[model samples]
Target: MIPLQRPPLPEELVERMSARGERLPQYRGGARELWRDSRTIRRELSAHLVAMAAGLSRCMYCGDSEGTSIDHFQPIAMAPQRAFDWLNHLWACAYCNSNQKRDLYPMDRDGLALLIDPTADEPADHLDLVLATGAYRPRTAKGSETIRIFGLDRPVLERGRAQAYVRCRSMLRDLARLAEHAERAEAGAVAHALTVQPFADVLYEMLRLRTAPRAALVFGAETVAGLNMLKDPRALRGPLHN
Candidate 1:
Protein backbone atom coordinates (compact mmCIF):
# COMPACT_ATOMS: atom_id res chain seq x y z
CA MET A 1 0.00 0.00 0.00
CA ILE A 2 1.11 3.57 -0.63
CA PRO A 3 0.41 6.80 1.21
CA LEU A 4 -2.62 8.59 -0.19
CA GLN A 5 -3.69 12.13 0.46
CA ARG A 6 -7.13 12.19 2.06
CA PRO A 7 -9.38 14.64 0.34
CA PRO A 8 -11.34 17.13 2.43
CA LEU A 9 -15.09 16.89 2.80
CA PRO A 10 -17.17 19.88 1.87
CA GLU A 11 -18.71 21.79 4.78
CA GLU A 12 -22.23 20.93 3.66
CA LEU A 13 -21.40 17.25 3.52
CA VAL A 14 -19.75 17.37 6.94
CA GLU A 15 -22.84 19.07 8.38
CA ARG A 16 -25.09 16.39 6.88
CA MET A 17 -22.96 13.65 8.43
CA SER A 18 -22.95 15.46 11.78
CA ALA A 19 -26.73 15.67 11.70
CA ARG A 20 -27.02 12.02 10.76
CA GLY A 21 -24.69 11.00 13.58
CA GLU A 22 -26.68 13.04 16.09
CA ARG A 23 -29.96 11.28 15.31
CA LEU A 24 -28.75 7.77 14.38
CA PRO A 25 -28.56 4.94 16.87
CA GLN A 26 -25.21 3.20 17.37
CA TYR A 27 -26.17 -0.04 15.66
CA ARG A 28 -25.48 -1.68 12.33
CA GLY A 29 -29.00 -1.48 11.00
CA GLY A 30 -29.41 2.12 12.10
CA ALA A 31 -26.11 3.07 10.50
CA ARG A 32 -27.22 1.45 7.26
CA GLU A 33 -30.55 3.22 7.35
CA LEU A 34 -28.95 6.56 8.15
CA TRP A 35 -26.47 6.27 5.28
CA ARG A 36 -29.26 5.34 2.90
CA ASP A 37 -30.66 8.83 3.35
CA SER A 38 -27.36 10.67 3.24
CA ARG A 39 -26.81 13.16 0.43
CA THR A 40 -23.05 12.95 0.95
CA ILE A 41 -23.20 9.25 0.33
CA ARG A 42 -25.27 9.84 -2.76
CA ARG A 43 -22.73 12.30 -4.15
CA GLU A 44 -19.51 10.63 -3.12
CA LEU A 45 -20.52 7.12 -4.06
CA SER A 46 -20.84 8.12 -7.70
CA ALA A 47 -18.98 5.86 -10.11
CA HIS A 48 -16.39 8.37 -11.30
CA LEU A 49 -15.42 9.56 -7.81
CA VAL A 50 -15.09 6.03 -6.44
CA ALA A 51 -13.00 5.03 -9.44
CA MET A 52 -10.75 8.06 -9.12
CA ALA A 53 -10.19 7.70 -5.39
CA ALA A 54 -9.64 3.97 -5.87
CA GLY A 55 -6.73 4.70 -8.25
CA LEU A 56 -8.85 3.93 -11.32
CA SER A 57 -6.89 0.74 -11.74
CA ARG A 58 -6.44 -1.83 -8.97
CA CYS A 59 -7.80 -2.81 -5.56
CA MET A 60 -6.27 -0.80 -2.75
CA TYR A 61 -5.79 -3.87 -0.57
CA CYS A 62 -4.25 -6.47 -2.87
CA GLY A 63 -3.10 -3.97 -5.48
CA ASP A 64 -3.73 -6.56 -8.14
CA SER A 65 -7.47 -7.03 -8.77
CA GLU A 66 -9.81 -4.56 -10.34
CA GLY A 67 -11.35 -2.17 -7.82
CA THR A 68 -15.12 -2.46 -8.14
CA SER A 69 -16.78 -1.19 -4.94
CA ILE A 70 -16.61 1.17 -2.01
CA ASP A 71 -15.48 -0.22 1.32
CA HIS A 72 -16.09 1.25 4.73
CA PHE A 73 -12.67 1.29 6.39
CA GLN A 74 -14.49 1.44 9.69
CA PRO A 75 -17.31 -0.92 8.95
CA ILE A 76 -20.74 0.58 9.57
CA ALA A 77 -21.55 -2.44 11.74
CA MET A 78 -18.82 -1.64 14.23
CA ALA A 79 -18.65 2.14 14.10
CA PRO A 80 -22.05 3.62 13.38
CA GLN A 81 -20.72 7.00 14.46
CA ARG A 82 -18.63 7.08 11.30
CA ALA A 83 -21.36 5.69 9.07
CA PHE A 84 -21.41 8.63 6.68
CA ASP A 85 -17.94 9.96 7.43
CA TRP A 86 -16.04 10.47 4.18
CA LEU A 87 -12.73 9.72 5.89
CA ASN A 88 -13.92 6.19 6.62
CA HIS A 89 -14.56 5.26 3.00
CA LEU A 90 -12.14 3.32 0.77
CA TRP A 91 -12.09 1.88 -2.71
CA ALA A 92 -11.87 -1.91 -2.90
CA CYS A 93 -12.44 -4.91 -5.06
CA ALA A 94 -15.56 -7.02 -4.53
CA TYR A 95 -13.51 -10.00 -3.37
CA CYS A 96 -11.61 -8.03 -0.74
CA ASN A 97 -14.73 -6.22 0.49
CA SER A 98 -17.28 -9.05 0.54
CA ASN A 99 -15.31 -12.27 0.55
CA GLN A 100 -12.19 -11.51 2.59
CA LYS A 101 -12.76 -8.43 4.76
CA ARG A 102 -16.43 -8.43 5.55
CA ASP A 103 -16.83 -6.32 8.70
CA LEU A 104 -13.76 -7.78 10.44
CA TYR A 105 -11.90 -4.87 11.97
CA PRO A 106 -9.31 -5.58 14.64
CA MET A 107 -8.19 -2.90 17.07
CA ASP A 108 -5.26 -2.07 19.34
CA ARG A 109 -5.23 -1.62 23.10
CA ASP A 110 -5.88 2.10 22.64
CA GLY A 111 -8.93 1.31 20.49
CA LEU A 112 -7.14 2.61 17.40
CA ALA A 113 -7.56 0.65 14.18
CA LEU A 114 -5.15 -2.22 13.65
CA LEU A 115 -5.92 -2.48 9.97
CA ILE A 116 -3.64 -0.49 7.70
CA ASP A 117 -5.30 2.54 6.17
CA PRO A 118 -3.80 2.52 2.69
CA THR A 119 -4.71 6.16 2.27
CA ALA A 120 -3.17 7.15 5.59
CA ASP A 121 -0.02 5.02 5.81
CA GLU A 122 2.70 3.42 3.74
CA PRO A 123 2.05 -0.30 3.83
CA ALA A 124 5.73 -1.07 3.12
CA ASP A 125 6.35 -0.01 6.72
CA HIS A 126 4.48 -3.08 7.94
CA LEU A 127 4.69 -5.39 4.95
CA ASP A 128 7.32 -6.72 2.54
CA LEU A 129 7.04 -8.37 -0.81
CA VAL A 130 8.50 -11.84 -1.23
CA LEU A 131 9.32 -11.82 -4.92
CA ALA A 132 10.20 -15.52 -5.05
CA THR A 133 6.82 -16.71 -3.81
CA GLY A 134 4.79 -13.72 -4.90
CA ALA A 135 3.50 -13.49 -1.34
CA TYR A 136 3.54 -10.69 1.21
CA ARG A 137 5.44 -11.03 4.47
CA PRO A 138 4.32 -9.10 7.54
CA ARG A 139 6.88 -6.76 9.03
CA THR A 140 4.59 -5.77 11.88
CA ALA A 141 1.49 -6.95 13.76
CA LYS A 142 -0.72 -4.69 11.68
CA GLY A 143 0.69 -6.21 8.51
CA SER A 144 0.13 -9.75 9.78
CA GLU A 145 -3.49 -9.07 10.62
CA THR A 146 -4.06 -7.27 7.35
CA ILE A 147 -2.67 -10.17 5.36
CA ARG A 148 -4.89 -12.60 7.29
CA ILE A 149 -7.98 -10.41 7.08
CA PHE A 150 -7.55 -9.73 3.37
CA GLY A 151 -6.16 -13.14 2.43
CA LEU A 152 -3.40 -11.27 0.70
CA ASP A 153 -1.38 -14.43 0.26
CA ARG A 154 -4.15 -16.39 -1.40
CA PRO A 155 -2.86 -18.39 -4.34
CA VAL A 156 -4.51 -16.21 -6.95
CA LEU A 157 -3.09 -13.02 -5.48
CA GLU A 158 0.30 -14.63 -5.00
CA ARG A 159 0.41 -15.66 -8.62
CA GLY A 160 -0.65 -12.23 -9.75
CA ARG A 161 1.93 -10.42 -7.62
CA ALA A 162 4.61 -12.82 -8.75
CA GLN A 163 3.81 -12.10 -12.34
CA ALA A 164 3.89 -8.40 -11.64
CA TYR A 165 7.24 -8.73 -9.91
CA VAL A 166 8.66 -10.54 -12.91
CA ARG A 167 7.44 -7.82 -15.23
CA CYS A 168 8.88 -5.15 -12.92
CA ARG A 169 12.22 -6.89 -12.74
CA SER A 170 12.27 -7.29 -16.48
CA MET A 171 11.65 -3.60 -16.93
CA LEU A 172 14.45 -2.71 -14.54
CA ARG A 173 16.87 -5.00 -16.35
CA ASP A 174 15.84 -3.51 -19.65
CA LEU A 175 16.34 0.02 -18.36
CA ALA A 176 19.73 -0.84 -16.93
CA ARG A 177 20.86 -2.22 -20.28
CA LEU A 178 19.48 0.79 -22.14
CA ALA A 179 21.16 3.23 -19.75
CA GLU A 180 24.56 1.89 -20.84
CA HIS A 181 24.40 3.44 -24.32
CA ALA A 182 21.44 5.83 -24.01
CA GLU A 183 21.81 9.49 -23.13
CA ARG A 184 20.62 10.68 -19.71
CA ALA A 185 17.49 12.01 -21.41
CA GLU A 186 16.79 8.62 -23.00
CA ALA A 187 17.26 6.81 -19.68
CA GLY A 188 14.85 9.20 -17.98
CA ALA A 189 12.24 8.40 -20.60
CA VAL A 190 12.71 4.68 -19.92
CA ALA A 191 12.10 5.16 -16.21
CA HIS A 192 8.93 7.14 -16.95
CA ALA A 193 7.65 4.24 -19.02
CA LEU A 194 8.24 1.87 -16.11
CA THR A 195 5.91 3.86 -13.81
CA VAL A 196 2.93 3.31 -16.07
CA GLN A 197 2.98 -0.46 -15.62
CA PRO A 198 0.62 -2.37 -13.35
CA PHE A 199 1.84 -3.20 -9.81
CA ALA A 200 4.24 -0.27 -9.83
CA ASP A 201 5.09 -1.09 -6.21
CA VAL A 202 7.58 -3.68 -7.36
CA LEU A 203 9.54 -1.01 -9.15
CA TYR A 204 9.22 1.35 -6.18
CA GLU A 205 10.57 -1.14 -3.63
CA MET A 206 13.66 -1.79 -5.77
CA LEU A 207 14.22 1.95 -6.02
CA ARG A 208 13.83 2.43 -2.27
CA LEU A 209 16.78 0.06 -1.73
CA ARG A 210 19.00 3.11 -2.12
CA THR A 211 17.88 4.84 1.08
CA ALA A 212 15.96 2.40 3.28
CA PRO A 213 17.94 1.11 6.29
CA ARG A 214 19.47 -2.35 5.85
CA ALA A 215 18.00 -2.21 2.39
CA ALA A 216 20.68 -4.47 0.96
CA LEU A 217 19.76 -7.13 3.50
CA VAL A 218 16.07 -6.58 2.89
CA PHE A 219 16.17 -6.46 -0.93
CA GLY A 220 19.58 -8.02 -1.73
CA ALA A 221 22.64 -6.85 -3.69
CA GLU A 222 21.33 -7.28 -7.24
CA THR A 223 18.20 -5.27 -6.45
CA VAL A 224 20.26 -2.50 -4.86
CA ALA A 225 22.72 -2.52 -7.74
CA GLY A 226 19.95 -2.26 -10.32
CA LEU A 227 18.49 0.82 -8.61
CA ASN A 228 21.90 2.34 -8.01
CA MET A 229 22.73 1.88 -11.68
CA LEU A 230 19.58 3.77 -12.61
CA LYS A 231 20.37 6.54 -10.13
CA ASP A 232 23.98 6.87 -11.31
CA PRO A 233 23.01 8.74 -14.43
CA ARG A 234 19.91 10.03 -12.62
CA ALA A 235 17.67 7.77 -14.66
CA LEU A 236 15.44 6.45 -11.85
CA ARG A 237 14.67 9.64 -9.96
CA GLY A 238 11.14 10.33 -8.81
CA PRO A 239 9.26 13.02 -10.75
CA LEU A 240 9.73 15.49 -7.91
CA HIS A 241 13.42 14.65 -7.65
CA ASN A 242 13.96 15.05 -11.36
Candidate 2:
Protein backbone atom coordinates (compact mmCIF):
# COMPACT_ATOMS: atom_id res chain seq x y z
CA MET A 1 0.00 0.00 0.00
CA ILE A 2 1.11 3.54 -0.67
CA PRO A 3 0.19 6.94 0.71
CA LEU A 4 -2.51 8.58 -1.41
CA GLN A 5 -3.41 12.20 -1.84
CA ARG A 6 -7.12 12.96 -1.59
CA PRO A 7 -7.85 15.65 -4.13
CA PRO A 8 -10.60 18.11 -3.40
CA LEU A 9 -13.92 17.14 -4.93
CA PRO A 10 -15.98 19.54 -6.98
CA GLU A 11 -17.92 21.98 -4.80
CA GLU A 12 -21.25 20.70 -6.12
CA LEU A 13 -20.29 17.10 -5.42
CA VAL A 14 -19.16 17.95 -1.92
CA GLU A 15 -22.46 19.67 -1.22
CA ARG A 16 -24.41 16.74 -2.59
CA MET A 17 -22.47 14.25 -0.46
CA SER A 18 -22.90 16.37 2.67
CA ALA A 19 -26.64 16.70 2.07
CA ARG A 20 -27.00 12.96 1.50
CA GLY A 21 -25.08 12.14 4.66
CA GLU A 22 -27.26 14.50 6.65
CA ARG A 23 -30.41 12.82 5.34
CA LEU A 24 -29.20 9.26 6.03
CA PRO A 25 -31.31 7.92 8.90
CA GLN A 26 -28.38 7.05 11.17
CA TYR A 27 -28.83 3.34 10.44
CA ARG A 28 -26.76 0.84 8.53
CA GLY A 29 -29.67 -0.12 6.28
CA GLY A 30 -30.32 3.53 5.51
CA ALA A 31 -26.72 4.05 4.54
CA ARG A 32 -26.74 1.01 2.27
CA GLU A 33 -30.00 1.95 0.65
CA LEU A 34 -28.92 5.52 0.03
CA TRP A 35 -25.62 4.42 -1.44
CA ARG A 36 -27.32 1.91 -3.68
CA ASP A 37 -29.98 4.31 -4.87
CA SER A 38 -27.78 7.33 -5.54
CA ARG A 39 -26.38 6.36 -8.92
CA THR A 40 -24.98 9.81 -9.75
CA ILE A 41 -23.14 10.11 -6.44
CA ARG A 42 -21.60 6.70 -6.85
CA ARG A 43 -20.58 7.25 -10.45
CA GLU A 44 -18.97 10.66 -10.01
CA LEU A 45 -17.22 9.73 -6.78
CA SER A 46 -15.85 6.52 -8.25
CA ALA A 47 -14.56 8.29 -11.36
CA HIS A 48 -12.52 10.68 -9.25
CA LEU A 49 -11.20 7.81 -7.18
CA VAL A 50 -10.13 5.84 -10.23
CA ALA A 51 -8.38 8.88 -11.63
CA MET A 52 -6.28 9.16 -8.47
CA ALA A 53 -5.52 5.46 -8.11
CA ALA A 54 -2.13 4.02 -9.10
CA GLY A 55 -1.50 1.71 -12.08
CA LEU A 56 -4.79 1.77 -13.95
CA SER A 57 -7.02 1.96 -10.86
CA ARG A 58 -5.33 -0.59 -8.65
CA CYS A 59 -6.78 -1.37 -5.21
CA MET A 60 -5.79 1.05 -2.48
CA TYR A 61 -5.15 -1.75 0.00
CA CYS A 62 -3.58 -4.55 -2.00
CA GLY A 63 -2.19 -2.45 -4.89
CA ASP A 64 -3.12 -5.35 -7.14
CA SER A 65 -6.26 -6.16 -9.17
CA GLU A 66 -8.73 -3.58 -10.48
CA GLY A 67 -10.38 -1.34 -7.92
CA THR A 68 -14.08 -1.75 -8.66
CA SER A 69 -15.78 -0.85 -5.37
CA ILE A 70 -16.04 2.04 -3.00
CA ASP A 71 -14.85 0.84 0.41
CA HIS A 72 -15.54 2.77 3.56
CA PHE A 73 -12.37 3.10 5.62
CA GLN A 74 -14.60 3.21 8.66
CA PRO A 75 -17.29 0.61 7.96
CA ILE A 76 -20.86 1.84 7.58
CA ALA A 77 -21.95 -0.77 10.11
CA MET A 78 -19.83 1.00 12.69
CA ALA A 79 -20.09 4.61 11.52
CA PRO A 80 -23.22 5.12 9.48
CA GLN A 81 -22.82 8.90 9.80
CA ARG A 82 -19.68 8.72 7.63
CA ALA A 83 -21.27 6.70 4.87
CA PHE A 84 -21.07 9.58 2.41
CA ASP A 85 -18.16 11.41 3.97
CA TRP A 86 -15.41 11.83 1.37
CA LEU A 87 -12.59 11.17 3.83
CA ASN A 88 -14.06 7.79 4.77
CA HIS A 89 -14.29 6.56 1.18
CA LEU A 90 -11.54 4.49 -0.56
CA TRP A 91 -11.22 2.70 -3.86
CA ALA A 92 -10.82 -1.07 -3.37
CA CYS A 93 -10.84 -4.32 -5.26
CA ALA A 94 -13.87 -6.62 -4.92
CA TYR A 95 -11.77 -9.22 -3.10
CA CYS A 96 -10.49 -6.85 -0.44
CA ASN A 97 -13.83 -5.11 0.00
CA SER A 98 -16.32 -7.97 -0.01
CA ASN A 99 -14.32 -11.13 0.62
CA GLN A 100 -11.65 -10.11 3.09
CA LYS A 101 -12.51 -6.93 4.99
CA ARG A 102 -16.31 -6.92 4.85
CA ASP A 103 -17.57 -4.74 7.72
CA LEU A 104 -14.88 -5.65 10.22
CA TYR A 105 -13.46 -2.62 12.04
CA PRO A 106 -11.19 -3.57 14.90
CA MET A 107 -10.22 -0.91 17.39
CA ASP A 108 -7.60 -0.46 20.08
CA ARG A 109 -8.12 0.33 23.75
CA ASP A 110 -8.00 4.04 23.00
CA GLY A 111 -10.73 3.66 20.38
CA LEU A 112 -8.42 4.24 17.40
CA ALA A 113 -9.03 2.09 14.37
CA LEU A 114 -6.50 -0.73 13.89
CA LEU A 115 -6.52 -0.86 10.10
CA ILE A 116 -4.23 1.43 8.15
CA ASP A 117 -5.94 4.08 6.02
CA PRO A 118 -3.55 4.41 3.07
CA THR A 119 -4.67 7.93 2.24
CA ALA A 120 -4.07 9.11 5.80
CA ASP A 121 -1.04 7.01 6.72
CA GLU A 122 2.29 6.13 5.16
CA PRO A 123 2.27 2.33 4.85
CA ALA A 124 6.08 2.06 4.94
CA ASP A 125 5.97 3.46 8.45
CA HIS A 126 3.91 0.50 9.67
CA LEU A 127 4.95 -2.33 7.35
CA ASP A 128 8.23 -3.45 5.77
CA LEU A 129 8.33 -5.24 2.44
CA VAL A 130 10.74 -8.09 1.72
CA LEU A 131 11.66 -7.50 -1.90
CA ALA A 132 13.02 -10.97 -2.51
CA THR A 133 10.00 -12.72 -0.98
CA GLY A 134 7.26 -10.13 -1.64
CA ALA A 135 6.04 -10.61 1.92
CA TYR A 136 5.01 -7.80 4.23
CA ARG A 137 6.51 -7.69 7.70
CA PRO A 138 4.36 -5.79 10.16
CA ARG A 139 6.19 -3.15 12.18
CA THR A 140 3.11 -1.95 14.05
CA ALA A 141 -0.32 -3.22 15.15
CA LYS A 142 -1.95 -1.25 12.35
CA GLY A 143 0.26 -3.02 9.84
CA SER A 144 -0.59 -6.46 11.28
CA GLU A 145 -4.32 -5.77 11.14
CA THR A 146 -4.10 -4.33 7.63
CA ILE A 147 -2.32 -7.44 6.32
CA ARG A 148 -4.81 -9.73 8.07
CA ILE A 149 -7.84 -7.78 6.92
CA PHE A 150 -6.70 -7.38 3.31
CA GLY A 151 -5.10 -10.79 2.96
CA LEU A 152 -2.07 -9.02 1.57
CA ASP A 153 0.15 -12.03 2.13
CA ARG A 154 -1.74 -14.31 -0.25
CA PRO A 155 0.60 -16.34 -2.47
CA VAL A 156 -0.53 -14.81 -5.74
CA LEU A 157 -0.01 -11.27 -4.47
CA GLU A 158 3.40 -12.16 -3.08
CA ARG A 159 4.48 -13.64 -6.37
CA GLY A 160 3.21 -10.61 -8.27
CA ARG A 161 5.02 -8.18 -5.98
CA ALA A 162 8.27 -10.10 -6.30
CA GLN A 163 7.94 -10.05 -10.07
CA ALA A 164 7.25 -6.34 -10.03
CA TYR A 165 10.37 -5.78 -7.96
CA VAL A 166 12.50 -7.52 -10.56
CA ARG A 167 10.90 -5.59 -13.43
CA CYS A 168 11.26 -2.24 -11.66
CA ARG A 169 14.92 -2.89 -10.94
CA SER A 170 15.55 -3.70 -14.58
CA MET A 171 13.73 -0.57 -15.71
CA LEU A 172 15.77 1.47 -13.24
CA ARG A 173 18.97 0.07 -14.73
CA ASP A 174 17.77 1.02 -18.17
CA LEU A 175 16.88 4.46 -16.89
CA ALA A 176 20.34 4.90 -15.39
CA ARG A 177 22.02 3.91 -18.66
CA LEU A 178 19.78 6.29 -20.56
CA ALA A 179 20.68 9.10 -18.16
CA GLU A 180 24.39 8.37 -18.54
CA HIS A 181 24.07 8.65 -22.30
CA ALA A 182 22.22 12.01 -22.04
CA GLU A 183 19.07 10.44 -23.47
CA ARG A 184 16.61 12.55 -21.54
CA ALA A 185 13.57 11.50 -23.58
CA GLU A 186 14.30 7.79 -23.22
CA ALA A 187 15.03 8.25 -19.52
CA GLY A 188 11.67 9.95 -19.02
CA ALA A 189 9.93 7.08 -20.80
CA VAL A 190 11.64 4.55 -18.53
CA ALA A 191 10.69 6.58 -15.46
CA HIS A 192 7.08 6.64 -16.58
CA ALA A 193 7.25 2.86 -16.94
CA LEU A 194 8.16 2.58 -13.27
CA THR A 195 5.11 4.60 -12.22
CA VAL A 196 2.47 2.89 -14.38
CA GLN A 197 3.01 -0.73 -13.34
CA PRO A 198 1.13 -2.86 -10.81
CA PHE A 199 2.51 -3.32 -7.29
CA ALA A 200 3.88 0.22 -7.38
CA ASP A 201 4.97 -0.32 -3.80
CA VAL A 202 7.90 -2.29 -5.13
CA LEU A 203 9.38 0.70 -6.89
CA TYR A 204 8.50 2.95 -3.95
CA GLU A 205 10.26 0.67 -1.50
CA MET A 206 13.33 0.38 -3.68
CA LEU A 207 13.64 4.14 -3.81
CA ARG A 208 13.01 4.45 -0.07
CA LEU A 209 15.75 1.96 0.74
CA ARG A 210 18.32 3.41 -1.63
CA THR A 211 20.26 4.97 1.24
CA ALA A 212 19.79 2.24 3.81
CA PRO A 213 22.75 0.52 5.50
CA ARG A 214 23.17 -2.30 2.99
CA ALA A 215 21.39 -0.87 -0.01
CA ALA A 216 24.20 -1.88 -2.34
CA LEU A 217 24.04 -5.51 -1.25
CA VAL A 218 20.24 -5.67 -1.46
CA PHE A 219 19.65 -3.68 -4.68
CA GLY A 220 22.96 -4.57 -6.38
CA ALA A 221 25.51 -1.97 -7.53
CA GLU A 222 23.84 -1.28 -10.86
CA THR A 223 20.40 -0.84 -9.30
CA VAL A 224 21.84 1.32 -6.54
CA ALA A 225 23.47 3.53 -9.15
CA GLY A 226 20.17 3.66 -10.96
CA LEU A 227 18.44 4.74 -7.77
CA ASN A 228 21.05 7.43 -7.24
CA MET A 229 20.42 8.76 -10.76
CA LEU A 230 16.78 9.28 -9.77
CA LYS A 231 17.85 11.87 -7.18
CA ASP A 232 18.17 14.42 -9.96
CA PRO A 233 14.80 16.15 -10.28
CA ARG A 234 15.07 15.82 -14.04
CA ALA A 235 15.18 12.02 -13.80
CA LEU A 236 11.80 11.16 -12.28
CA ARG A 237 10.08 14.43 -11.46
CA GLY A 238 7.64 14.24 -14.35
CA PRO A 239 6.25 10.77 -13.75
CA LEU A 240 6.66 10.29 -9.97
CA HIS A 241 5.86 13.77 -8.68
CA ASN A 242 2.74 14.16 -10.76
Winning candidate number (TM-score): 2
- 61 in model 1: Cα distance from truth in Å? 0.6
Candidate with maximal lDDT: 2
Model 1: per-residue Cα lDDT over 102-182, one tens digit each:
999999899988789977888889999776677789999899999999998899878876787777666555666666666
The TM-score values for the models, in the order shown, are: 0.74, 0.93
Model 2: weakest 10-residue lDDT segment is: 233-242
Q: What TM-score does prediction 2 earn?
A: 0.93
Error of 2 at 13 (Å): 0.9
Q: Judged by lDDT against the true structure, how good is candidate 2? A: 0.87
**Can you give the lDDT of residue 108 in candidate 2?**
96
Instruction: Report lDDT (CA) for all predictions.
Output: 0.70, 0.87
